[model samples]
Target: MDDTLREDQKLTVRAVLAREGRGFAEEIGLGRTNNPASLFGLLVTAVLVAPRGESSGPARAAHEVTNRWHTPADLAAASAQDVAKELGAAVEGVDRGDGDDSASDTAATLVALASAVSETWGGDLRGLREKAGHDPARERELLTALPGVDDGVVDVYFREVQPLWDEVAPFAGTRALRAAAALGLGESAEDLARYGNRPEKIGRLAGALARIDVEGSHDEVRRTAG
Candidate 1:
């Protein structure tokens, strides 16, 4: 009974990740960072610099962070100044439309993320997944404990990271959630699994659902399914 129940849940969230979550993730370049730890770093950095930071900033920061620190311990041990220097180097290559120096908070957040992950989960993101298993609530709790992570980053992570944590449902931000409702999938995580049983299928569905919100054509999904 439990196994069946879990599979059902997996199907719902995976569908959203694959279907509705991809384009949204890619628009912000969040999907390109494959390493789970790097993904976390990118999410943290993006949130820190939001409302002013460059759209490309997260990708640069993630790449620099993953490159500079080979291990969780390495990242955790880095001084704030070291983090700032690496992030500064990353920003130098990007066009920050406004030509603003917006990396300080991002640097601080990544440093906090590194310290938290290293201390709490031994720096192995996979271990955190293993600990959470397929339970979204537990994942939420653990992610919440991370020093610099917030609700927005958490939602984005759960949406774009289907490949790493396939069990988590894609959280279609405010816009996409409305589309999910239009498609008859309730706003809750479990309601999403009913859309598809396979993880890959679910991921595609997640991308598809998110596309609706983006395109402002909820009818497109209905037409496609037909």
Candidate 2:
């Protein structure tokens, strides 16, 4: 990948990040923070956000459950019915316009996600990292094995977790890559990282790119870039 970014690329990176840079975890106060607490927040947020038609509903729902259960063990201990009640309350009257069915589905997914983490990694993602030998591909494979984790959810998790997991640095998923291409930042993770210009900036940039797609701000970002 090229080391230097064009003027448009630079502007796009700067503007998009300035406006919508924070990842879902960060917006919910997790902030790309690495610790078990933050990791649980990121993982659960990924699961919640992956299936929602719009992010705000899941984002609100994440706040509700994450605050209620600080750790995966706490969540895993709760009955799916109880989780559904909380998620339903949080998701109700949200912008996603989803009904009770959506909330119930999300509740089931959250319970399964927490149970998998609690049982497999003892509520600590570091165990998963160790099990994967810190290999990004292996980490991805292991992550996919977790309940409610599919390719899309993995993308959401990877974008946020890259800041914590060293081997996964400079990672960008399909959503981020699409946004990057729209902004002239190239289509590959490596290409996006070059535009980021620093190790720490890579995750943030990838996150911002993903948000452009999610929030439908690509054209606005492009205009800002120009």
Candidate 3:
């Protein structure tokens, strides 16, 4: 929608995608296909997985949870407390200290959001998909109705899922922001999202940002790259 990205921004995104595409594809078992649902799931899982630090354990745990319960309906049917407890149990060997609580919180939030989605949209992702046709505003409103889905989750969902449904503006986040900052394109996800317009641009931006190691601040990346 917005054609604001520069040539450098496009190159940065392309570079990142090239670096991380294989790993991400393998990690998510999507192979070479760029299906919207799978992409959406990966991004959503990333949010829940908490890539802030020591993500391998949490990422594995999140994958396990998704495999055990694939759809929003599966999550909606779960007991929040029980789901939390189950996630806490699942992460036992991988995580330490209060990590279990974080897992529990993530589980609870996911389940609650799923339940809300089910109640609002007939227990199917299609409901949201349908809304995308008539009114994006309503679609977003429905998406935000889920308890754990904040603006951050919404952004990820829209960007990753829209490709599956139809072309739309890219929704950037911390990952993209970090990448943009790394490339000297912008300082934050919001800026990058506003800048990226085309699908190629979005893909490239996401790819580049995904390559950055998720340690230290954007400034640290700049200093290290120098």
Candidate 4:
């Protein structure tokens, strides 16, 4: 948490990354985003790992199903093994992969995730959003009730939708915090995101920061460690 950012460079990075983050957000077309569905995608993607990482793991694990599942009801009705197969395909193509038979866990977790979403949120992700009432803490509480969504995934989902929720500088995982730290942005990506006029842009910025380390731009992050 030491502020290693030099005064001269700090202004430059802050301005540059902030602008870049907003542009990136626009490129991703999050300007007029739909609620619940987009948030659900974030939740699913977070289950596997970094969605923006170089590997296609996120695609196989979640993105492959995002367009397919569309809602908790969609996933809940599908066979659990079919849901698991998407992740199975994605993980197989990656390196230094997870050791366990995550496919099985993926199946069970996906089933449970979809079931919880269906029963609790009534298959409308917006219900949870409505219940959150713009409070990030409340949002986190609701998200944690889902099967696969933990603190990390909750942060991911909320931050991706932060443009609507009006929360500043959200991070998906600790690696992102460290990634920002390496760039002299400080240990807390949230704080750096707050420096920008549009804080939601930090969600994308956090992803970029975390990806740098995953691609070996910095020391490797032990992502699987709890």
- Top-TM-score structure, candidate number: 2
Which residue window of length 10 is worst by lDDT in model 1?
46-55
Q: Give one digit per residue, the lDDT tens place, for model 2 in 116-181.
A: 888889889999999999998898899999888988888778877876786887788888888888
Q: List candidate 4 segments past 4 Å from native.
A: 1-32, 50-56, 92-100, 168-173, 219-226
Q: Assess each prediction's global lDDT (C-alpha) against the native.
A: 0.56, 0.76, 0.53, 0.59
Give residue 144's error in model 2 in angstroms. 1.1
Following a full C-alpha superposition, what root-mean-square deviation does model 1 have from the true structure? 7.4
Cα displacement (angstroms), candidate 4, residue 201, comes to: 2.2
lDDT of 4 at 83: 68
- TM-score of each model, paired residue for residue: 0.57, 0.87, 0.63, 0.72
> Candidate 4: deviation at residue 28, Å?
9.5
Cα-lDDT of candidate 4: 0.59
Ranking under lDDT, best-scoring first? 2, 4, 1, 3
The window of 10 residues in a row where model 2 has the poorest summed lDDT is 90-99
Candidate 4 residue pairs that clash: none
Residues 1-226 of candidate 3: C-alpha lDDT, one tens digit per residue? 2466665555544444444432332454532224333543554454554333323444455565566666667767877555565455434342333446665677777777666656776656566656777365666676666676655555545544444544444555566566566567677544655545554355445544644645434444444434
